[model samples]
Target: ARWSPSGDRIAFVSNSGEGSEIYVYWNTSNTTSKLTQLENGPSSISWSPDGKHIAFTMKVNAKAPVIASMPAKPKGAKWAKPPRITDRLKHEADGAGYLKPGFNHIFVISSEGGTPRQITTGNFNHGGNISWSSDSKNLVYSGNRNENWEYDFRNSELYSSNINTKEITALTDRNGPDYASKVSPDGKHIAYLGYEDKVQTYQLTQLQLMKSNGENKKVLSNKLDRSINTAIWASDSKGMYISFDDKGKTKIAFIDLAGNISDIVENVGGTTLGRPYASGSFSVSNSGKIAYTYSRPDRPADIAMVTKKNKKPIVITAVNDDLINYRTMGEMEEVWYKSSVDGRDIQGWIVYPPNYDSNKKYPLLVENHGGPILNYGNRFSTEIQLYAAAGYIVFYPNPRGSTSYGEEFGNLLYNNYPGEDYNDVMDGVDTLLKRGVTSEDKLYVTGGSAGGIMTAWIIGKNSRFEAAVVAKPVMNWISKTLVADNYYGYANSRYPGQPWENFENYWKFSPISLVGNVETPTMVMVGMNDLRTPPSEAKQLYHALKLRKIETVLVEIPEASHGIASRPSNLITKVAHTLAWFEKFK
Candidate 1:
């Protein structure tokens, strides 16, 4: 989506027939016009400073496959399917299916309506975070045009291209991937985020500053150890505001000319629509007004506006007011306790069954989050709320390796993921058990992706839980490194070496290695089309349990990917299946 330079109008893409088309709407007049009819969807859209034209990124069609011969047949004779051949390492992606042969390129069209013209030409794909200079003469974007662009994925550089002359110039020359350049209001400096490619398991993305000519590059966030998720320059250019996570909570802060950091707001997220995960966005206007999505433990993101510093924000839109007013929600409570294995504090949230009795114990459901790099915070979660509504006490913990914590804590599982994280979560369960909030007989555990790995790990290590539902987990590292959507990072950065060099360590970390001890009635679930943690991974655990004469069932959500809850119906199905499994054991 592209907001006009004057902020008077907005242009966005929408689905049209078989593809997508661009449209512009006037905020004042409430008038809209169809702009372009393109074959493929436009990925990025940018409005020119004068609002006379729009620049966007669209995929260029890949060349047709080369076939040795074509067999002649009758009018409608059946032909054998062509085999896919590719020398590229990164080919297909989840949700996108087998990738089409194409690269993303930049294009521009007049706001008055005309044929769109292609700007940048290359075999390599151009990426988003496209920024236009104040004069509207040039466009800056990130891409890797090197010979081995695909293999050297972490070597993107910032480049500028003249809109008319088509002349290109390299702005920043760095080994690491550098993009997301936002030209300052004065157009003298550019603020972007990147880090040197040290090939480490975890590296913080530092906010950087450089001249318009790409000189005198400095890391503005050098002192900040936590990663910067988003950065926007203040209207004056003397400082910039950034949003980052700290210890499972997301906050927005401002960094001034003297390198002083002052928080503008805490708890800056509620963007995770389905669950309480760390996600949100903020934007600043030239008039110094800030607009963001406000969220809390009780509600999802609502439109909020703030003009003054350290002042309360006025929420403009209450998206969930009707639902919130009508439906009774579970009570959310924050819980903090030290890890039993290590003397470190762990954060989690517990949702109690509505109209609960403090004296009576309740069934416990431990939900693990994906992205050992992601976190669960004080945000409204539908999945958690649904479990609570089902008369279960739900606990979602941000264990070690969860982000929003500092770099050290996020990288704690660098070489030991699903290892000590188990202890951290089990300790959280123990905390509730000791308080008599949950009884051992009614314990249940479930998680997806990385959480799925932990769920499998939990049942294998301990049988305290009555039932388990492991969803979309990497049952074996060797297979995951080969088939997972992210084929490179799993071994290269997460571990020190390739599977061949570190076979012993890889085998040791795999959840399947300990499946022999499984005795719990486990339900292995996965998305039928999950590329991140393929169905094979779930099958491995199912087969392992069956071989041990253990009670187990495999559930595959049809037409779903890594994110099983991506669709509304799928989310309901996931929750239904989970509750059924847990209830059966109870």
Candidate 2:
């Protein structure tokens, strides 16, 4: 959905199916009209400031490449299908699978209704967010329009396209990515998020500003340590509203030209249901009002707003009230402990069971978070809460490589992942154990993706846990580095070079390398179609455990991608299977 410049109308596609029609709803008249009927639905919709035209990006399919073909069969006979051919570095994604042979091009349509006109051309994808200049004569967007765009996937530059002439102009020229361009209300400057390529595991995305024509680029968020996720210009063009994760919490703040940030609100997430990674979006209205998706530990997102008079936000909508009000949720608490490896203060969250008894001894579940770069904050997580409700004190920590902590902390895993980050997780566990939270025999560990890698590493490193559930993990880095859907994207940044060039470095960090030492009762799980960390990775662990004569089981979810929890029933299946497996050892 895209909001009109006057904020009086909202343009949205009519349906999710193909051939969806764009419809504009007028707030003043409470009327709606079909704006356009396109074959494929439009995305990245943006309205011109003058409220005259709407710009969106759409896929324009290209003819499939054909090699040698068999002779044309008779009309009645249906011969075998032709073999598909692909020579691209990234031909398929985890969820999207193989992509259509086409490029996404920008198209413009009248706000009223008209045939859309394509502006940008060529084989490059201009599908990123579209922002308009204040004058409404030009459109700004991000794309890798380079000749070597497919290979240099990490690099992107901002481009400005004249609506009438269809002339494209590059506005950024850095080795790293420079995208997410947001032109100020006054059209004096353009702000974006990017960083110089350091060829490292992680880099903080800084806020940068330049003149409308892309001159005099300067980093405005140099003083801010944490990466800024979203940036929106103030209505009056004084400062910008930015959302970022600080420590373990997500915050919405205002930053002036000098980079001084004053927080407007905290808990700016609830959209990511599977895990509590940083997520959410906010936008500023003309009269100094901010609307955002409100987040909390007890519930998912609800519509919220804050005004200049009331700096504190007001939750205006209760979308989850029916489900949340009736449920007795676990209590979540945050704690900070020093890392045994470096004496760094590591933060983690403890979710206590519902109606807890201080006298009772509850089993502890160490639920490691994915990303290895993403942090698990004190936000609502149905998965973690489910574990807590099942009578285990769920402890999720933001280890050394987790984000929101400065760039140094997040990039510590460069060429050393499953490295000290493993110690950071164990240190949190040891701290809780020393406080008599749970004994060694009652411990259970589980995590998916990167979290799964850490969980496998944990159980292999020690025999304290009663059982372990390693879901969709990279058991063998050498295999996974070349096998996953994002295989080409992890080479130099993750390690020093290609897997073959740095074979020892890759294998050294793999959990499969430590599989021989694992003694915990294990249940390895993965989505059957998980391309990110494919089902083969899970089977490697299962086969190894079987050969070792260890108590183990394999659970493969069918028709699921890397995001097994994307479907509600799939989420239930994952949690149910995890509980059933953990229940066995208990």
Q: Highest lDDT among the candidates is held by which one?
A: 2
Clash counts per candidate, in order, are 2, 0
Any runs in candidate 2 off by more than 4 Å, and if so which?
28-31
The Cα error of candidate 1 at residue 390, in Å, is 1.4
Report the Cα lDDT for residue 49, model 1. 80
Residue lDDT tens for model 1, 1-586: 7788888889999885567888999899999888898878887788878888888899999775675666777797888897786656677888777787888888888987789988889798786688888888888888888888888887888888888988889888778989888888789988888989877656788898889888989999877888899988888888898998877677788897566787777667886767788888898888778888887777788978876474477889988898888888889999999998778999998999888889889999999998878888888788888999999999999998888767788888888877789999999999999999989899999999988999999998999999999999999998888888778656667887888889888888999999988889999999999988889999999998898889999999999988889899998999999999999999
lDDT of prediction 1: 0.86
lDDT of 1 at 507: 84
Report the C-alpha lDDT of model 2 over 1-586, residue by residue, as the tens digit. Answer: 8888778999987674457778899999999898887867788888999999999988888877777778878999978777888776877889888876788899999998989999999989886778899999999999989999999899999999999999999999989988889999999999999999989998999999999999989999888999989998988888899999998788988899877878888878899887788888887888779999888988898879986457787999999899989999999989899998879999999999999887877899999999988998988898988988899999999999999989999999998988999999999989898888788778999999999999999988999999999999999988997888899988889889898999999989988889899999999999998999989999999999999999999988889999988999999999988888889998
Q: What is the TM-score of each candidate against the true structure?
A: 0.96, 0.97
CA displacement after TM-score superposition, residue 181 of candidate 1 (Å): 1.1
Against the true structure, candidate 2 reaches a TM-score of: 0.97
